[model samples]
Target: MPQSNINRRTVLAGGAAVAGVSVMTAGITSGAAAAPATGLLSGGRTPGAVIPPSDPRYEVLITGINKRFVAHPEHIKMIRSAHDAEDAVRRAFRQGKRVSVRSGGHCVADFTCNPEVEVILDFSEMNAVEYDYRRRAFVVEAGARLYNVYEALYKGWGVTLPGGICHSVGIGGHVAGGGYGLLSRAHGLVVDHLLAVEVVVVDARGRVRTVIATRHEDDPNRDLWWAHTGGGGGNFGLITRYWFRSPGATGSDPGKQLVNPPKRVIAHSFDVPWSKLTEAKFTRIMKNVGSWHEHNSGPESPYRHLSSLFNVNSRAHGRLSLYTQIDADIPDARRLLDDYLAAVMAGVGIKPVATTKPSGELAAMPGFLEPRELPWLAAARMVGAPDPVGANPEARVGLKSAYYKKNFTDHQVATFWKYLSDPTLTGVDSTLVVLSFGGRINSVAEEATSSAQRSSVIKVIFQNIWAFEKDDDRFMRWIRAFYEDTYQHTKGVPAIDDVTDGCYINYPDMDLADPQYNTSGVPWYTLCYKDNYPRLQRVKRRWDPSDFFRHSMSVRPRN
Candidate 1:
């Protein structure tokens, strides 16, 4: 990993207090049912069930996966069962209060963890995953962590569900948002195999009902299952449990899902120097690797044994780094790797320093989720095919990308480079990362699951991480300018525009919704959902018409 020149002392010099709060207890108190001016219950609750401010559990409930956004809600309701969730929603709705439901607290925008929230329907107490060998499936509680689920499946049935990279992320939001990870390239998305969901629905009359939606194609509520695939969380009703159909199964068989865990999974990292390479060289490498992946995707392809991610980070400090990952066994892996490297070096030229290691399945999982830890301050935009232009002598920059398709045209490649090399941008990190997107991912259709970017050949993430929070305006301006410049460069260019699908939801950025940033009027959902937005909106209307569950970019109910 490239080290940042910005010192730790410099980051804290601004004295911005990290926002956080304490977890309230589970019990309720008297007069807590009164609705605040915001229409949400700001306080007052049933006696004997309230967790007062004096309780010890108060502190733990407020922190989240990011620890970036934290504020105490008026009240915290710890739900032990699906019934508790249903009841909580009903109370909040009856009081005309805005409610936030929290699963793992991984929400970057503080949707469920926000201080403005009056009622928090927390599911942390419901972490449980049960395997039914006879049915060849697992019923997982919403609060279950990815790691816990993995542990449970492997221990009880020697099986696992394909899901996100982080073990700490809650299944509720993860699956509701169309979870994907290492197994994705092989097993498809987590939702692709979803069998059923147990949700707490609040009717217009303020009555609570527990409803179940299954994968049965003939089920009337099949659309509910589709919405969970990628519709995102807080839109549909609160899902307490998810049932997953075991992959590669013939009727009921627990052992079917447990492929002999790879005896040895090896990883290799290649870091190329930005100073030594020209813009043309960088573009060539991106195009070559991208094309290779697109051509070799599907059940076939000579390099099917390998899964790789390529990224470039460009900064205003004149730093550039390109990184790639190849997943394969150590023996023949080197040869397969060389082929990729050669393709990258075809037109442009740069020799990269490579590092290789063998890791167990558990240890290797984190590698796929690597980008999550990078200091992210701004929202991200997804780029399909990127072309690297010559280095901008005036600006320090970094760039990175993930290739889903095998290749892009030279014109597409050039257009990408032009955007990154633009001047006038400042206070941003010079970095870029290109991740590998396709292998088994492409085999699934856009509608097959809620994750709609399946047609994209590349998933480009543009990020800027700087040292000072005070530099927020300048940094944001720089990144937004870069994004617009990139979009402008590709406008009307068939090869670039036609193939340049929008952005990723996980890399959420509110700027995409701003008319100033998104001149195309393409709402963020269009970038993330495409045709699936309308369906998601329908689900949102059906489950949360009052929009009780919402955030900046959450699915909105259509009129």
Candidate 2:
């Protein structure tokens, strides 16, 4: 999607009613809850931690990015440092409780906030992005959000990590799941620059210790670091911090060595009113998008710095929007952008309209708006808003995702249009967000990291955003049916086919692991990890032999 700055305030601004806890009927729990208490850990109070279900902040603490699942942990430790995280893990082990860690609280799946969790280690307060001279890398705490990392890295050293656009998405999960954003086309995935990681792991002997793993060969714990590279969170251990530096980057001159942020960026948008959109028009648009990306998304493409998000909203939403951005530093940037758009129109047999063309509520032609130029930081701050249209971040969300090796097939495109054009569906907030993927990101080998889907050209996110509890069933049913039908030819889920590469682990869907929902016969782990599943499982066995860290979709030990 178009890169936008996501910060804490905007992320929590709007959404559905406060979520309720999904308590597992038989999980371990503390006996009869009393008044709020502290000192849940061995040390006195552990600074400012709070044992939950009793503390006033319990509800807020467990409410995460999706708001669909609420955790009811017996204890919520407000961890301020790595020591705090280690201590919390030790406590969970001693108490025989299942532990879950929260950073930006953005897991789409119920992994972080389910009833199975007995202890929650909150890292929200530990957010810090700084240059570590000793390590020769930029150190980002797991709790730090993308916006924070961007701002800090840009202002301090003129470098940044190519991560997700959501500002409030914590680095912990984002990087662990192979973080990507608009810059991914130019810088590759975040894991490509990952140099080292600090994690709190539990051994088979039940001892909790902090381990620093790195990409360096001599490092005995190098495999541990490899697992963190797109292995997904809540698998082997609780990550405390990550260190980033471009591969082969040397010297202390951060500005001269690491990837620099675009000096300036040009942002542009076009609106295609739904009223003017027929099935043919929609098909043409999808075809144009697919064709354009297929041609331009190569490691050496001159348009690598340009990326756009095509948001196909349902008919009830009145309009579909396309947001595009390009590095203004490139020569004749305006002409490049114009030519790119013109080429897209050509692919669909249409003429470009004037930049200032006035658009009606449902214009037959896309109305292009004047492009705006902003400095790197200014653009990031403006673009970083969670929603492209700046919607409230508190909106409850359900998401399903897929990676495309090429473009949509004719059947898939028709299926999309059929469900999206359905007048009977009531969730107007739902949309299909197609993000431009590939470029330098694809240059990496599939086996280099756990994120094995290296050749995808587009990333598709199926989203349902709503605000009412009563509408939950309706929204869920709508999204589920839409997804099922879209992939009906593939056994109710996206398998590794010519058109699909399963789903993104970062956008984890429990349905992929459920036999009731996934009848494709291909295991969810294979869908997400492909050939990397075995290595990840081995890492899990080594770091968490007791299976101390786990979730519904966590990597399991080899049988």
Candidate 3:
């Protein structure tokens, strides 16, 4: 793979070293609730599919999204429904084995593919999307990928759930971690529309049962539902299904209740040659983005209809680019696009930014490369395609993330430029991507859900993709150094301070929890969940008193 075109899979599901696995035998139970031979759970028929180490598909099932950390579970059980999931959990508990759940197989960290994971409950077969009359919302099974969810919703009722751009991302973990996407600025987060969830949880007595929790104010299990929203997955239980109905939608008619899919989408790509970029120029471009998003990120801002990603590739990559999209059905979309582009380059110390149609050719000048318009579904598919480099078994990647309340300081900007332009940093494909944030999402109260990051204007993702295991140390050291330096003001971590609002939980970096790396004097949970951590701990205690499901970054039960 070319170093410039990094794989999205690697970007999303990087790798980490395996931590020691802990064993627990107190929760064991095998007599009455033993999983039936028919693979039937309490409510549904599961396939009872088991792929042992000898099975040919075991290797494929064990390969994570990044193809970096390949787990070797004792066995893999396929879950077809909530009942199946519960059965799998019961068996794992009875066997005194640690259980790990895999939905889309895209966890960025080693949460599900760790050494402690003995039994793997694979949800790949449980994918199903349909409207549920009783729930008055769309019922999405945990195994469903974002692409399946989008297609099902759009085709079934001309509605859409604004989610991540990756089609292959599983809804199980995505929604649980407070999923966001291109339209998040306009529609808020996917969690904003979450109404209920079906989870298979182990009780205090070690009994496995499925619980359906909803957002209804009087629902006895309301906290369970709230914990699923941005609480991050694998904390309380294994999520089996999610019910989505936009908040305030009273009608049971799925078509009329949910947000309508965009009528059309306009996709634009801007390519800036490295020769045209300087430290000052780069700083100006980023400043424009930071200030623009901060000022315009409101429920009523016209710019909320726009979302763009500024991908700053290392100077070694020889170019920088912007991927932009907008709902064309909005009024004055053309003018909005043009004005936004103009504003980004307004003070970048560059002249005559060129514009042209996408001609399948490299741009000789710094300007918009290709401007193509497509129907909503087509555009969505194009955006979510995985990068081929991710399939390379030899490739390994590492990721780190942060949310910014405002523009980067001069020092931060200079640090990025210095690292990117460094002559010594070579071979690794590194990039700093700035995603547009804060719009309708900020309209919601931070305390309303587990996702407490409502004030940030921009979210940053730091990535380093390399082709050799030998380069792991070098790549990790480079990325960590970059991240530490970027947040040096906060003691090498994005603590809840003036410039940073903590980190995104979905990124799941264990380094933030290690005192050796995080000298910020702030607990990693504070950086990931902020004030919501206490509430999460309470819910964790209530729902998972035995601490059944957990990982390095999973929420801890109250002491």
TM-score of each: 0.74, 0.87, 0.88
Q: Which candidate is the best by TM-score?
A: 3
| Per-model root-mean-square deviation over C-alphas | 12.6, 9.5, 8.4
* lDDT measured at residue 63 in model 2 versus the true structure, 0 to 100: 64
TM-score of 3: 0.88
RMSD of 3: 8.4
User: Please, what are the lDDT tens digits per residue for candidate 2 over residues 1-559?
Assistant: 1121222112111101111111111111123111121212112223446766877767777767666778877778877666667767887799899888888787877888888888888787767565554446676778887887888788777888888776777888999999998889888999999987878888888888777777877666888888988999988888877878899786768664467979999877776677777788789888888878888899878788988877688887766777778999988888888887776556454433332321111122233367878787776665566342213446577789988888788888998899888998766767898898899999999988888988888999898877767788888888888888888999888779787887899998888888887888999999999989999988888989988888989998764
Which stretches in model 1 have alpha-carbon errors above 4 Å?
A: 1-72, 258-261, 302-305, 315-334, 354-430, 466-468, 489-497
- Residue 414, model 2, lDDT: 95
- Which tens-of-lDDT digit does each residue in 54-154 have in candidate 1? 67866656655434346576677877665567667778888877778878776655667677777777776677566533234566778877666665666
Candidates ranked, most accurate by TM-score first: 3, 2, 1
Overall local distance difference test of candidate 2: 0.75
lDDT values, one for every candidate: 0.56, 0.75, 0.76
What's each prediction's clash count? 71, 12, 1
1-559, model 3: which lDDT tens digit per residue?
1011111111101000011111111111222211221211222343558999999988878867665566778999987756567668888888788888888877768888887788888887767676655445776778888887788788868888889877767889999999998889899999999987877888789988777777877676889989998999999998877878898887657687677867897777776666888778988887887777777777778888889877677877666667788888899887888888888888786653333322111122223344566898987876565433334455576889999887788888888898887877784358887898888889999999999999887899887777777778898899999999988888888778777899999888889989888997899999999999999999999989999898879898998
Task: Determine which window of 10 residues in candidate 1 has minimal summed lDDT.
Answer: 375-384
Winning model by lDDT: 3
